[model samples]
Target: MAQPYADTIACIRKSTAEMRDLQRGAMDLDAPGTEARLEQTVRELQARVDEQQAALEQLRSSSHVDIQQVAYASGNPRDKLKQLRAVTAAYTGLTTVAPFLPSKDSMLPALLAARALQQNIRGTKQAIASAEAQITANGALLKQEESNLHDANLIEKALRDRTVRLEAQIEDRSQKAPAQLAKELIAAKRAEKKRHDEETQRLGDALNDFVDNYLSAMLAAEELGGPVVGDMLNVENETLAAGFTKKGKAKATKKLVSGKTRQRRIDQIWGSKIAVEEEEEAPLTEAEAADAEMRELIGILFKTLTGPGGGRAYHQLERDSAASRFLIRAKIAQFHPKDAQKLRLIDFGRELDD
Candidate 1:
C-alpha cells in the first residue's frame, strides 16, 4: 500500500534535494556573464547609432559647398550648369551618407533582435517565479507530512504504554497464587493464541485476495497497452500469480483450522489441553475477557521459559498489549518470583487498581 502522506514526504525531500540544482540553473540564465554579454551587444549598437549620426551631420554641412564647386567647374550653359550642379550635389549627399543611413534593412533587423532579447529576459523572470511557487508548495507539503508523522508517533507511544502497564498488572496478579494461577493462565494463553492465530490468518487471507486482484488488474491493463511489456510483464505476472496462489492456499488452510470444531478435535486428541475450554463456551463480558487475555499472556511467558524458541516469541508478545499481559502473568505464576508485587483489585475484581 502506498501511504499518501509518506509519499508526499518523500516527494518533498526529493524536491528539497533538487532545490540547489534548480536554483543553479535559474541563476545561470541571468548570470553575470549573460548580463555582461547583453550589455556589450547593446553598447555596440549604441556606438553604431552615434557614428551614423555623426556622418549624417558631416554630409549635411558639406552639401552646399560641393554643389557650388560642381556648378563653377562645369563650363556649360547656365541652365545646363544649374541642372548638373543640382544633380551632382544630390549624388554627393546620397553617397556620403549612404553607409551611415539607418536603412529599412538594418534598423528593422536590429529592432527584432532587441525584442527577442527582451522576450528572453521576460521568460527567465517567469521561470524564476515558477520555481519560487514550487518551493512554497513543497514547503507546505513537508510541514503536513511532519505533522502526520508526529501524530502517528503519539499513537504508537500510547499503545506501547498501555501494553507495558497491562503486562505489569498481569505479573502482579499471577504472583498471588502460583499453581492455580499457572493452570488458569495456561488455559487463557491457549485461547489467546488461538485468537491471535485466527486474526493473523484472516489478515493473510485478505492480503492474498488483495494481491490477486491487483495482479489481475495489472494483467488486464497490460493486455490493453498499459505500461507492462516484454520480459518485464511476463516475469512480474508469473511471480505475482505464484505468490498469490500460495498465500491464498495457506490462508484457507489456517481459516479452516480456526473454527470451534477444529478446536474440539484438537482438544480430544490432546488430553493435556488446559481447562480454559469453559471460557470458550460463551461470550465473555469485557472484564472477563480482559482477565482471560491477561492470563493467556502469562501462559505464553511460561511457555517461553520452558519451550524451544520461546524466548524470542515471549519478547515479541511483550510488544502487544493483550499478549504482553498474558505472558507476564504466566511468568510470575510459573516462577513465583518473590519480588513480583500483587495487583490491586478493582471494584469489579477483574482489573488492577490504579
Candidate 2:
C-alpha cells in the first residue's frame, strides 16, 4: 500500500493542478466575475502550497530519516533488500505524487503551472485595477452632477421667492389703486372750490366798503361847506368844484358870470391860494380789468372764513375799502391768518362790557 504521506502529497498535487486549471478557465471565459474567481483560486493555491511544504518538512524530519534505519535492522538480506526497495519506492512515489514537493524548483510541470498561475493573477489584478479606476471616475462624475443639481435647485428657489414677493407687492398696489386716485381727485377739487369762494368773498367785501366810505366822505364835505359858501369865501368855485355842479341852474349861472369880474373876484377871495387840482382819472385798461377779475375769482374760490358780509357783500366791501390805508392793514390782517396771529387780533377788537 502507498504511504499516507504519499497519498497526502498526491492530494495536494491534484488540488494545485485543479487551481491552475480554474485560473486558465477564468482567463478563457473572461467574464465579469472571472478576475475575482481567479484571485480567490490563486490565494487558495498559495495556501495549499504552504500546507504541502509544511507536510514535506514534517515527513523529512522523522519518517525519511528512520527509513534507512528500518532497512538496516532487517535480519534477512532479502528482507533488507525488500525494505530498501520499499523506501526507494516510497521516495519514487513522493516524487511522482508532487513534482514540486521538496522545493519549488523540483518539478518542471509545477514550475510551468506556477508561472502560468502568476501571469493569470497579474492579468486579473490589472483588470481589477482598471475596473476600480473606472468606478472611481464614475463616482466623481455622479458627485459633480449632484452638486450642479443642488445649485440649480437653490437658484430656482430664490427666483421663486423673489417672484412671490413681487406678486404680493403688485397685488397690494392694485388693491389700493381706486381709493388712492379718488382721494387725490377729491382733495384737488376741494382745494379749487375753496380758492374760488374766498376770492369772490374778498372782492365783494372790498366793493361794499369802498362805496360806503366814499359816500360818507362826500356827505361830511357837504356838511362842512353850505351851498352859498363859494360866494361868502369869494373863491373861484369853477376850478374847485367843476364836476360837482348841478345840471341846469349851476351850468347857467357859471355861463352868465363875466370873465374879468370872475377873475378879480376869484383873486380877491383867495390870492395865490394852493389849488387842489383834481387828478385826471385814467380808466382801467383791458389787462388791468382782466387781472382784477381774476383776483376776484380767486378770492371767491378760496374764502374759507365767512367775513362781515356774505359772498357778494364781502366782494363789494373789499373793492371799496381796498385803497384805504387803515382798512388795507386791517383787511390784510383779517385775510391772512398768520398776520392776525402776529398782531394778536383774534377777537377783532371786540371787548366784553363789565
Candidate 3:
C-alpha cells in the first residue's frame, strides 16, 4: 500500500535532481575557454583591422610624386611639364628652382615607387576587409550564443518551476495518505463510540424494564397469590445490626445489605439467557468479515497516532464562533502542514467546547 507512495516520492525527487543538473548545465554553457577564446578572436581580428587601416593610410601618404613623375601628365609633354614645374615651385617649400623635365635616372624610380604605393594600398585595404569580415562573422556567432543563453535561462526557469510544482504535489500526496487515513480513523472511532453508547443505553433501559416487571410481579404475587414470577427471587429488606453506643443500649447506625438477592438475580438472568432488546444479528458473514478487517485497519491507525511518543499530534484547536463549522470542514479547526516534513493531527474537541 505504501509502496506506491514511496515510489512517487522517489521519482519526484529524482526528477528535481535531474532538473537541478540541467539548470547548472544551462548556466555553464560557456564554460572554461569558450568566452575567453571568443574574446581573444574578436580582439585579434579588430587589432588586425586597425593595423591594416594604419598601414593603408601610411602607404597613401608616402611620397609617390617627384618632379620626374609629374612630368608624365596627360597633355603636350613639354608645355604641360613646364607648367607643372612652375606650379610645383610655387606650391612646394623648396630652396631650389624646380626642373622642367626629369632625367631618365629619376623618372623610372619615381614611377616604380608610385606603382608600389598603389599596390600596397590595394593589398592593405583587402587585408582590412578580410579582418573586418572575420570579426563580423564571429560577432554574429557571439550574438547567437547570447540568444542561446537567453533561451537557456527561460528554459531553466520553466523546468525549475515544474520541479517545484512536482515537489509540492508529491509531498502533498505523501502527507495526504497519513492525513486521510487519520481522518478515516477518527470517523470510525466516533462511529464505534456512538454505537457503543447507544448499545449501553439500550441495555440499561432493558434492565430497568426487567426489574420493574419482576418487582410488580412479586408485589402482585404477595397480594393475590397468582404468579410464581418472584418466588425464587425475593430480596429481603435491609436490616439493622444492633450495637452498643458509648452511653447505653445497642442501636443501629447503618443498614446492611444481603448477598442472597444479588446472587439470585445473577442466576435468574444467566439461566433465562436474557438478552438486550435489540434483535441480534448473525455474524460470520461477508459484511461482518469486512467490518472485522476494517476494524483491524482502524486499530493500526489508532496505534500510528496516539499509541507512542512523537506520533501524530492531535492539536486542540482554537475556535471561531462565526466560522467554527467551516473551519472544521476545511480540516483547519486544528491544522498542520500536509507534508511529511511535519506530521500532526488536529483535534476539534477544544473548539467543540468553545
Which numbered prediction scores highest in TM-score against the true structure?
Answer: 1
Instruction: Encode model 2's per-residue lDDT on 1-354: one tens digit a residue.
Output: 224544655565566667778766745665555555555556667887898889888887876456556736588899778878888898988776744333332233444676877886667556656655766677789889899999999999999999999999779767787889689779989999999989978977886565343322332122223233223232223432321345212232354545455444433332323132368354332222223333443344335224443322222232222222233343432333333221111233443111
Q: What is the lDDT of residue 173 in candidate 3?
A: 65
- Cα-lDDT of candidate 3: 0.48
Regions of candidate 3 where Cα sits further than 4 Å from its true position: 1-105, 178-354
Candidate 2 global lDDT: 0.49
Per residue, candidate 3 scores C-alpha lDDT tens digits across 271-317 of 22222235754312211222232233324434545656434544332
lDDT pick, better of 1 and 3:
1
The alpha-carbon lDDT assigned to residue 128 of candidate 2 equals 54
lDDT (0 to 1) per candidate: 0.49, 0.49, 0.48
TM-scores for all predictions: 0.22, 0.22, 0.21
Residue 78, candidate 1: Cα error in Å is: 63
TM-score of 2: 0.22
- Those runs of model 1 whose alpha carbons end farther than 4 Å from true positions after fitting are 1-124, 136-144, 147-151, 190-354
Q: Model 2, clash count?
A: 45
Order by TM-score, highest first: 1, 2, 3
Screening candidate 3 with a backbone cut-off below 3 angstroms (N, C-alpha, C), the clashing residue pairs are none
